[model samples]
Every structure is written in structure tokens, then in C-alpha cells.
Target: MNAAATTHHHTSCLRCGRKLTSTKSVATGYGPTCTRKVKAAAKAEVVAQYKPHQVAKAEELIEQGGLIPLRGQIYLAVSSDGSQTYKTHRAACSCPAGIKGLHPCKHRIAAHILSLAA
Candidate 1:
């Protein structure tokens, strides 16, 4: 059997436990409205967890395609200077700020955001 045919889908929305009638909803395990609300809440949580500047820089890096995935959970992020790159991971980054453990650097934040989206 095909993978899609073998897969088991939920009959209720995963978020609200509402009955799911549509094929797409069942497959995704969330209703359309619940999907939007869940996404918004996740975005809000990310924003609240990080500094505004760090979030902004991470968004910029994503928009610019400046983060390059390397091995597992590792990425190369372009430095603010645009001339250098730093090794970035969800837990650690090679940037100066990260090295000092002051706070999560933009590179590390960007890697984390990308992983969430993926």
C-alpha cells in the first residue's frame, strides 16, 4: 500500500478536539481555524521569548537566505558584517555574543526559528 493510504489520520482537531469532517483536516489533525490560531500562538511565543532585535535579525537572515544548513542541527549563518560566517546551532553559536554566553546570538536564534518552521 502507498504511504498515504497506510497513514492513520485523526477524526478530531488536535488543538480543540472538534470533529474533523474534511479530508485535509483529518490528515493534518487540525481544523482550518485551529491551524491558524496555533500558528499565531507559536509565533507569539517565539517573539515573547527573544529580544525584538534578535527576532528581527533572525527574520532578516531567513528572508535573505543567509542561513545555510550544514550537518545535523548545524548551520552556517552570515555575520552582520556580511563578510563572515559563523557556525550556528540551536543550542550554541560561534558568534562573539554566543561565545561569551551573554545571550543567544542572532545566528543561533535564526537556526532555532528555521528548525521550528521545518
Candidate 2:
């Protein structure tokens, strides 16, 4: 192939507008430093939306493999009792607390955490 045909044109970074040359950076649209900052900011936003206890529980659920990805943003969260599974999404969950709409449930929080990690 000719040099011009083989040459990869660098894309602008999504966060900083710097030219991205690395394959991973080009694919993700962010350079290494900007990628870290973007991910940290996203995680912080997710954490800020939930209570400390809820975030703790979500982390525990993730560590224990209690949250299983079903498809897309949907997940199957095993109940603490291990007797039931609830369909969960970042914004919605099938758990009782979620159904009642009192507040964001632990299952929902877990989904958000998992999404951010991905």
C-alpha cells in the first residue's frame, strides 16, 4: 500500500481536543489523561446520586458477582437473601423499593456502578 493510503489520520480527543494517535485513544475518542479524567468524573457523578450505604452495597454486590449482565443496560441482581433476582437498569429496577419509587434502589445503584466500570 502507498504511504498516504496506510497513514492513519489522528482524531481529536473528545475531552481535550488534542490529536489522538494511539489506537485505543482513537477508538475511545480520548487520550490517556483525558480518558482517566472522563472516567473519574463519570464515576463521581454516579456516586453522588446515591447514598453512601447504597454505594457500599452496590460495590459489595459487584465484588460478590451478585449483579449479572442480562443484555444492554439490563442486569439480574441476586437478592441479599439469595432467594430472588430482580431485573435492574441504571435508572430502573424491579425490586420492591424501586417499584415503590421511594428512591433509587441498591439494584439500580449496582447497575450504574457496573456501567461506569465498563
Candidate lDDT scores, in order, read 0.69, 0.69
- The deviation in Å at residue 17 for candidate 1 is 33
Error of 1 at 62 (Å): 1.0
**TM-scores of the candidates in the order shown:** 0.61, 0.62
Tens digits of per-residue lDDT, candidate 1, 8-117, equal 46687644569999887776666778655634543766688898888887766654446666777697776765666779997999888989988888788777776665
lDDT of 1 at 26: 76
Whole-structure CA lDDT of model 1: 0.69
Query: Cα-based RMSD of the predictions, in order?
Result: 11.3, 12.7
For candidate 2, write residues 8-96 as lDDT tens digits: 23387634568989876665455777555534644687767877888777766654456656688798777877667789998998989
Off by over 4 Å in 1: 1-44
